[model samples]
Target: MDLDDDILYEDDSGNESSENGDDQFMEMNMEPESSSSQKRDEVDDFQFEILTPDKIVSHMVDCIKEVNAVVEIPATTTRILLNHFRWDKEKLMERYYDGDQDKLFTEAHVISPHRSIVSKPKKTTRQTAAASSAEVTCEICFLSLPSKGLTGLECGHKFCTLCWTEYLTTKIMDEGMGQTISCAAHKCDILVDDATVMSLIRDPRVKLKYQHLITNSFVECNRLMRWCPAPDCGNAVKVAYSDAKPALCSCGHRFCFACGENWHEPVRCVWLKKWIRKCDDDSETSNWIAANTKECPKCRITIEKDGGCNHMICKNQNCKADFCWVCLGPWEPHGSSWYNCNRFDEDDAKKARDNQELSRSMLQRYLFYCNRYMNHMQSLKFEHKLYASIKVKMEEMQQHNMSWIEVQFLHKAVDVLCQCRQTLMFTYVFAFYLKKNNQSIIFEDNQKDLENSTETLSEFLERDITSELLVDIKQKVQDKYRYCESRRKVLLDHVYEGYDKDWWEYIDI
Candidate 1:
């Protein structure tokens, strides 16, 4: 199935457009409508471009040229200056025209192009040849060779071309550095320009790797670009402004442009990150232990019961106090009772029980949200496989005199279904830490409505269609999916409203 064969574009008016492309790209219409009709959904309406590797390189060159037109410096030097400012052309221009130019060049690790030099007698052709022929020892290899064989940067520290190639290769291949590679001379901070590195490195593999590293550095450092985080995907997204909004990659993987995780709606990036850390940690296991075990009253050592008797002894040799495990009180006070703890009614015992109950309750609450989150995630994974089933259904519908265009609604239904599931999955994470209030109750009600509708829509899609009921099934499926989309939007809009009005209150777990 050649799905995602084109890019999706969502304009400011919430309308969509698609173009046929050589590579796989899927456009997503996942943004929810704003609760207030007076305001536009600006979160996902920002300007951006989906760029391939070649396009990325072309764009970088275009930026350099655009800046070079005004600065009128060597393109190589301009590249160095741009890299210093993280590819922010506006910032670089401001600094260039309004600030100290020499300091700018110095901070970029390049010798100033306008530096003053004392006039000297120009050497003739014969004198130049004689000077080039004079042998000088290479500082690195300590080998004497003709001066023509040695080369260096503007800093005047010379090394053999062979040494320079090896040094650059190590920096490029071993250290995986390209944009920030410095001169190989000791304690020198001047950067080696791209032309110099390209000239020195002869290996095609190293050259390609160096080029890749350079492009990667440009994307990573540029505030306006983000590499699509999908596995094995080489595409990048370029935006006019940086914001925490959904970005659909050409690979059909949707992610948050700001944090690079899957596009999670309702739950902001901060809470999602905290929830992920909580899920990955072993703190829950420790909590379980705290609720189920008791400490030795004497040595403070933890103990778990393996026998029926309530009478217990501290295992520590230095302090073996006989105490009833049930109340953690001295056994001597129990007299001859060997099977029961008379001090179970003590204040300490009551407090300990209350603490254990609180720990257990908190653990159960976390699990409630975690299980729902995981269930939806697992369901979403399997939902992708539905495309194969959907293709078969699409074919079946076409064979039954239905036009190919008409059968596309099945595919659209599955897309909407997957998005609804995704949104429902994150609602649990938002609710888990939410402190109870009227606003939270309303959020949960919205969550419940969406969850119920999504499940019903999923079930409707999985039902087999027969020739007799084909027309009826199509109408039902369309209505169900439209309802699901509406509910999903409602849930999201309410959460967004909460964010704007500061209606959310959270409790620390």
Candidate 2:
């Protein structure tokens, strides 16, 4: 099967219109949908797309910034809340609204060191938020310090600046705990967030490492997110729906957003995986001729029954025994061809017959679909060559002052051929695995119509037609393309509907 890289691709003639031959291509219902509108309706509806690592980091920073503003908390406290909520902004709101604010702070492991036990302290205007208060005890170093000696988190843990910095630096740099660090107290379990890491970690390299961890967590923890599978792609995709699906990344890599596998459509993901494993497992032993081997009756040597007559002589001369290849019995009773030996065992003939019939029917059906699918792929390659020739033809006609736009019909025809051929290839895949029922017949009829339309479009694209005929051929191609696309979508929708109804439930095994 020509099931090569199935990613939908374009040869980057960016933004070139199919109807560029003439400003007046032809009167046809060939108005292409706006790409932005299409993306908005289908892809962007999930409020996500693949983004580069830089963009992911930027998004992470923005989320932290937004939480900081709304909660009126320091960035460290905001990050603690965010991490506690698994980076879900809505869940953070839910938790914040679910109970007492103090409870929220306690659960997030944030304690305010500046809390006054007796009464609320008078508002002071002189110092910034990061400034440490004087007269604090440094618990880690057991030092009594004057003012400006210590900073504290909401969790009420306080330590001298030197101790806090060393602890943060050690956790972030040496222990690789930059993603999260707890309070400096030996027994404390309060998890410090990135904001605190930035404040306490003096080294720029450690600060950068902490930032990277916190930023990368945005994609790592979300259910509706994943890093792109392509090597060095460094992009991720997220969507509200977490179902198995193929998505086109911004980096031009098409992949399964769920498992990060290559795009495989028509076949469901589970079924495709089973098929791949089966192929791998049977790769060596599944050869038709090799599988037909038998043992020599006389010497017990393994022998392959390569196609010939039923009569056979043992290759093991030491025990030269003439045995029928079919029955593996002495040749005298089998006579010449031994046609009678080919009969199934009467004792379990019914069971054996049913299995053989089923296997034959399934194999025939698969081959029927696979051959047609491959034929379309081959035809598509030829159509691509035809388009190249059309390009050369247009170049030669440059002296006539006839722009490709005036002959845009020919170009559009080529586009239609490509689109239809691709559709036809996968349509067969969908058909073969589809459940056998009345709908199967209807689906087949639809497929047949699409195949006819595709072939008709292909003929138009390949024809050596006069310049005057370009418009008519173009119009025909456009109409056929639209029809074929409609049919293709209908078939795909049917298969997807089958999946929803549990048509392929056991396919994975």
Candidate 3:
């Protein structure tokens, strides 16, 4: 039965055509779904609002041209466009439709605008106040209303923006009052301390409103001068003419000439002496001066008078006194000559005298040591030259007398002479090395060892007996044996002792 059914289906051409048509329909439907999923993923990843109706319509036209397929616009994008234009389908289509397919394929997509995304203007309380205060008149020029404009400072003082700007720019540019731009009102020199002027000028509208004020024209008046802002004080302050520093008033008020807050104190004027003197009484002044007094060489404690000579008077409360020029001690009445006032102590005087004697002794010892060392070095050098000459003569003798026995004997003698010369060299070298190493005792001991070794060798060589001569010759040959035996003795004792005594005496001083 199954074989018969297959044979019937194969024979029917309509059945094959129907199956192929169904497969084509499925592929057509799946293509759009896959393409739309890809586009939606791309749009989701972007941060900007680039998926507007206009941009979508522009992209759709390009997609249609590139694919040459009936591209259905994304449902998300279609809904967004519909909502933006109040669901007006015809208007959305008209706005987004691309007329030329070739052009759409070449150009980039455009973004559509939404009514909800429009930017709104900013407003602040200070700006609102400034606008309302535009009706107020400037005291300097006596001008009123919107023609001159208004500038509201942080201190809440309002002025014509033109007048304030002109005054500030001129003072800063021409007169070099570049730091301050205070209010122009009489006795109201509050500063305009705004931190956003750079940003405020970025707006074209604000810049246009205050253009004249920014130029060089306005002049700062005395009205800009203010009392020091110090608490409980009512001192009037002025800007220093020579320096930019602020002058303080008697009431302790501090204001800069540029109309900024008190940055620092100004130099005291010479004319303020009388005013300062009038502030306190005689006894009060005397006490005040004493408390603030400086000790003088001619007098003792005296009040400093500004703009006067260095000469002073003693104003001690107990003794209103005078003293001599040379000495700084108290003097008898009408005494013109100097008096010796230095008190002497027994121990201190003794120490001073001892120090002087010690210094002299040290100098004498240093000179003696220096002379001794120089003479010793000269003697060593002379001895070394003499020994070297003797060595050359010994070498010549060995060369002239060629008998084997005699040569052997002369070689032995040369060896002894070489040993003696080496001893001398080692003594000098060891002395220098010990001095450098601060081991003068060891160096001196080595020198004494060399001297003893030389004396013993000389005595052994001078002995008359043949056996003694042979023993001396053998001893001279055995350098290592002699060295081992002599190693335990005080070699450089004398040199070290002398050096130690000299060094200690010099250092003690």
Best by TM-score: 1
- C-alpha TM-scores of all predictions: 0.83, 0.55, 0.20
> Which 10 successive residues of model 2 have the least lDDT summed?
1-10
In Å, residue 436's CA in model 1 sits off its true spot by 1.2
**Which lDDT tens digits does candidate 3 get at residues 77-160?**
232233334433444455556554323222212122221355767769888777666576765567886633665543445566
Residue range 1-509, candidate 1, lDDT tens digits:
11112111112223222323211111221222223322123355865667777666656766776797788776677778999999999999999998599889889999887789999999999999999999999999999999999989988989999999999999999999988999988899999987677667766567667777877888999988999999999888988789888887767777888888999987888889999888889989888888778888678888888888887878788888888877777788888776566445678777876777898898889889989999999999988888899899889988899999888889999999899889989999999989999999988898898888889988878878677777888898899899989988888888898899999999777
- Indicate which candidate wins on lDDT: 1
- After superposition, the stretches of candidate 2 with alpha carbons farther than 4 Å from their true spots are 1-39, 43-50, 64-221, 226-235, 243-267, 272-291, 294-303, 307-339, 342-368, 374-411, 464-469, 486-509
Q: Is candidate 1 or candidate 3 better by TM-score?
A: 1
TM-score of 3: 0.20
lDDT (C-alpha, whole model) for all candidates: 0.80, 0.61, 0.38
Candidate 1 global CA lDDT score: 0.80
The residue-by-residue lDDT of candidate 2 on 89-149, one tens digit each, is: 9888877767577788777777743345787566556554334444556777878886466
